[model samples]
Target: MDISDKATEREEQDRDIALHQRKPEGPAATGQCLYCEDPLPPGKRWCCTACRDDWEFIQK
Candidate 1:
């Protein structure tokens, strides 16, 4: 690819990474696991490893 093409590709990759890391926000942001309905800790997002895996699969 050309230099400009490579730069565009990198930008797209960075956007994808940022989207993956972004979590839900707002009044709807309940303190619950992303995959399971279980409650999460103060700053937690997943209840267990399995739930995390399932959430990732769904995200994909």
Candidate 2:
């Protein structure tokens, strides 16, 4: 790929990574797991390994 193409690809990949790391942000999501609805660290997406796997499964 050309320089511009490679740059675009990298940018897209970075955006995807950022999106993947983004957590549920709101008062409602506070202390709740995004995947299993369990209590979690205040700003976390998945509460545990199981919840992370479940979310990754659904995403895929």
Candidate 3:
């Protein structure tokens, strides 16, 4: 299309990429502990060190 349309499309693509990159990956993204499946506090990935250790073990 036009140059203006190309610029808008590029902006939209950049926004989508940023949003995707900011999203958490793996079980942590679901707001539960990666191992125990317990509810997590805001910005927490695991409920405790045990769960965190379990996740680390599984990843290896």
Taking all chains together, each candidate's TM-score versus the true structure is 0.48, 0.43, 0.49
TM-score ranking from best candidate downward: 3, 1, 2
Summarize candidate 1's per-residue lDDT along 1-60 as a digit string, tens digits: 499999999999999999976876422335898777799776577888898788778876
> In model 3, which range of ten residues has the least summed lDDT?
21-30
Candidate number with greatest lDDT? 3
Clashing pairs in 1: none
Clashing pairs in 3: none
Candidate 3's residue-wise lDDT over 1-60, tens digit each? 499999999999999989966845554446788788898776677888888888988988
Instruction: Please list all clashing residue pairs in model 2, or write none if there are none.
Output: none
Residue 56 alpha-carbon offset, candidate 3, angstroms: 0.3
User: Cα RMSD to native, each candidate?
Assistant: 6.9, 6.7, 6.8
Can you write out model 2's per-residue Cα lDDT over 24-44, one digit (the tens) per residue? 642344678878788777657
Runs in model 2 with CA error above 4 Å? 1-30
Select the stronger candidate by TM-score from 1 and 3.
3
lDDT of 2 at 31: 73
Better of 2 and 3 by TM-score: 3
Provide the global lDDT of candidate 1 against the true structure.
Answer: 0.76
Output the better candidate (2/3) by lDDT. Answer: 3
